[model samples]
Target: MRLLALDRFTWRRIYWILLVFLVILITVWWQPNRTFPTGGSLARDSANPQQVKGAIQPIPLSVDLDVEKVALGEELFRDKRLSADNQVSCLSCHHFKRGGADRQTYSVGSGGVPGDINALTVFNAGFNFRFNWNGAYETLEDQIQATLQNPKAMGSQWNEVVEELQATPEYPKLFARAYADGLTAENIKDAIATYIKSLYTPNSRFDQYLKGDEQALTPDEKAGYQLFQDYGCISCHQGMNIGGNMFQRFGVIGDYFDPKDGITQADLGYYNVTKDEADRYVFRVPSLRNVALTAPYMHNGSVETLEEMVKIVAKAQLGRTLSEGDTDLIVQFLKTLTGEYLGGSLEKLALDSDDDITS
Candidate 1:
């Protein structure tokens, strides 16, 4: 009688159990379909994983830039008066003549203190999804504010800087031209951001080559380009600027953590902002534009030479070792990405000297 009663109880719960099973089974079976474009050169066998699955269609570059903002942005970019000291301008670290970089392992800030990482070039930074090596700032304006306020960088508080600017006669007029209101922290940030957005250098030899100008790249450069794609460098380093669109870990193939090296406190990369464990050591991939001039590669400025950078990349990303010759070719190809600054007449903003300020 007890067995008969237990059988009935089992049968009563059978429908409930089946319903739960079906829900779980459906969830397991249904995978969301995602799509992306195949990237890199037509001559090479380059295709994204999405392309392999035939879930995405290829799309060409299509977007018009605001020329007025870019023109105004160029002027504001060269203005040294943006800094409290007037000695440390945006161009001070990213000089136009020097391939938009200081070429130092680390940049010297206002008080002669070194920044943690090598200063990235300003060129095509607008193309990046996020700003900074660790992907800390979301926009150029945000980075500008952080840079200005950081004691190591500009070493000036917002209120004090504003008061100084208010005292200056030209700043009020410049602010009027740039923005309607005279000078505020928010407006200053917006104006600076507006100028940075205009700093794109789209036309390059590689761009011409992509547009079917076969002679744009030399024979060696063409070979190097092929090797770059074939060797799987383009998997992460792709898109309009060759890189700077995504984030990846420092040591993907090998464990970056060395207990002996005292690399305590997990870097956590974008995770600090998002709180995702997957973002550890991941950073915004830098633009290859003016790459030849921007030395001391990587987030911590670890790899000094481009050849070492290539080797490290090959080992960490590709999971393969690269020859010295192969590294040289890759470096040579990178050199082609350097574009000339179009803005010739960047007016440097003048500030009153100590005598002028007091007088």
Candidate 2:
């Protein structure tokens, strides 16, 4: 009789579990005409982006950097000896004059091969929590190493790079000055990473405005900032670097990819790293700092102008259409993000580049 009572109790628990599961299933199930959430719920809401929280903060005026290591790294960064071919270097894709990127739709890598994705700006990259569009790398050093070994990029092995750097007349003594191990692979990476970390840009007009300098930004630029928040562009693009702290899907409201264009491996985004079906088009939110200067927007570098890209981002991600005037105001605000490159060498390079172009 006791066993019978226990069985009855077990059956009652199972019945309750089944009932709860059914209720949850019904709650989430959408009607045939009504679609479910695809991450555009915030855009659909009426709240201002600033009111919704997560407004971007100003990048600090200063950061710690290894002075000696940065000097050595800057020289190494321009050395083409790191790539398989003697023609390419880190500077090949990252030109300081062109907004810390090549300004190409897609960068031309080793052997003149076009990269599958856009070459992101290296300016203010130290502020990014993760590296790359896929966020495959958590450290700047890892990203540098990966780039060196990538078949489409440097296409060179560490042993090859080490051999070349050791052969250089200046590199040996420079590395020795910077490290006890001198020219070891790790030391090379450390020096380069140190230099890259020092590439922080600061004191943009927007940052000045953020710091309570009300007169720093023009009236149109201020209005653009408001529209940027109101249009929900600020939802993903917030925090110190403006947008590098999180990952989000490329097209939340509508499909951004054309299957006919032949989706390449780069288009897979975070899926390439995790192999998760849910991560199909997930990407690290890129920093909007210096974005006005970096043209050919999007991962594929398909969008041409800042105005067009703004509209595309609004429609594709937020499921909203913006007027031309609204986009124009936002562009004006974005122009204020082009800050001074604090590194003297980079600033000189920009000036020299301009001089060379005009001469």
* lDDT winner: 2
Please provide TM-scores, in order, for all candidate models, with all chains considered together.
0.75, 0.84
lDDT of each: 0.66, 0.82
lDDT of 2 by residue, 43-102 (tens): 553274334453688878787888999999899888888888877889878878878887
Candidate 1, residues 1-359, lDDT tens digits: the string is: 99999999998799789999999999878844221112223123344444222211111233355454445455555666666677777777776544566666677787676676677877678777788877788888899889887755676687877777788866677666666666788877776677676566654566667667899899888888777876767656777666777777766777665667655232456666677787766766666766766677866566788888888877776677898888888888887775544533111111112232210
Clash count for each candidate, listed in order shown: 1, 0
Would you give me the overall lDDT of model 2? Answer: 0.82
The stretch of ten residues in a row with the least summed lDDT in candidate 2 is 30-39
Off by over 4 Å in 2: 1-54, 343-359
lDDT of 2 at 40: 57
